[model samples]
Target: MLTKYPTPKKLAHANLSKLTEILWNSSNGRFGEWKAQELKNLAHDSFGVENCEDIYSMALLTMLDEIQSLAEKADELEKKISSLLKNFDSTITSVPGIGPILDACILSEIGDVTRFRSADKLAAYIGVDPSVNQSGEYTSDHTRLPLPAKSRLDGLCCCCAA
Candidate 1:
């Protein structure tokens, strides 16, 4: 991008049509267009942040370290789940567009696949089955409202989307 606009200020004020073409590509577009317009506005208004270096305080850095540690823990758990999934011979992952993590999650929720007589039964158990919204006066098309019995709501989206 620097080949076209060499400086931050020059790129900052680049015309909207050209900027969108360049940015793949706000205010009206808000994140005010990915904070670029906000930057431009700040520059135009001569706005400045005081004591920006204070952002690097020990408290923020400690939280960042904790976040990194948690991320690593999550990755470890994901790998463990993927490994555990291999013991089950079910072809749940054979469904296109679904991945091992989702397959593992849905399978873990449904413990024994053989318990369900058919695919429809499995889908219903996973909270993906749509139910009629009807009263004496009105009825709406089938909508998926998560069953109170089912604690994991993510299954609704994963099953339907898959």
Candidate 2:
């Protein structure tokens, strides 16, 4: 789709039916008439960009290609990581909402939990353990809490959230 109409002006002024057919065909019929109209409207709205057709466009195009290549490599790396993670009996992977890639990355970072003396040490290492406030013989238990926001709507308001 971009190859056919790389410039905003060309896309904005393109014949409606032709653009729709190209978009439809390019997307294998997934993007139809509505998407074409949307793109056309978007192109019309974003005009007077000289760089779109200049030497900057070539650089932009090259960067886009590089991004696509990097994305493919990342996906491949993720699959390899997931496969590698299966060899270890990780409790992290057993937890709800935790996936293989994340577990693999975390396990790689915090290798061999036995190295930490205790669970508290692990928690402190990960920066989750809270610090206690103490001074000489006086130990403070009070923790500062966030102030409640002012009520935008009083009891007279119709909505519950408001």
Candidate 3:
């Protein structure tokens, strides 16, 4: 129903904004009524839920279950990250701005930093190096290039900035 033709960034931002609005609106007022009605309609059409009250309860429970599952997974990941940081803590503690966790992330992602020939090369690999346009004698920095290695450079910069 929306008329706006959004660019990539605008579209992404709009989507996130829409999600936030939906979450907020769902908490009260006409939005909650509309959501309930829509859910009832869908449940009635798809699952033959003649009574919307049961469907509403079911939907809420389902959302709660999903949230719980996500929380558990997040906790597991946190613990794993903690264990990893503990293992790499000593090695990465020397780097500025980066503690055990950041160092672990950098070390794990980058593997061996010494393999890089130069800082620029490393920067390019990490995906953070600014792009350069070299056409004839005219040279200037351009946009960032898409690369996996930029993440490594980002971590390095974070370490240095500390």
Q: Evaluated with TM-score, which candidate comes out highest?
A: 2
Please report, as a residue range, the 10-residue window in candidate 3 with the lowest summed lDDT.
1-10
| Better by lDDT, candidate 2 or 1 | 2
Could you tell me which residue pairs clash in candidate 2? none
Residue 13's C-alpha lDDT in candidate 2? 83
Per-residue C-alpha lDDT of model 3 across residues 1-162, encoded as one tens digit per residue? 012211222223344445445645656544543454454344344533335645555566677779879999988886787776664424656755665556666677777778898988766777767777688998875665665555555656656576
Encode model 2's per-residue lDDT on 24-121: one tens digit a residue: 88889999889888988999999575755666556666777898899999999989988888788788856655677667756766678889999987
TM-score-based ranking? 2, 1, 3
Higher-ranked by TM-score: 1 or 3: 1
Q: Kindly list the per-residue Cα lDDT of model 1 for residues 1-162, writing each as its tens digit.
A: 344444344555677566545545213343424455654555456533435524434445667679879999999988898788788886867877666777776666678878889987766776666677889989887675557346663543555385
For lDDT, the strongest prediction is 2
TM-score of each: 0.50, 0.58, 0.43
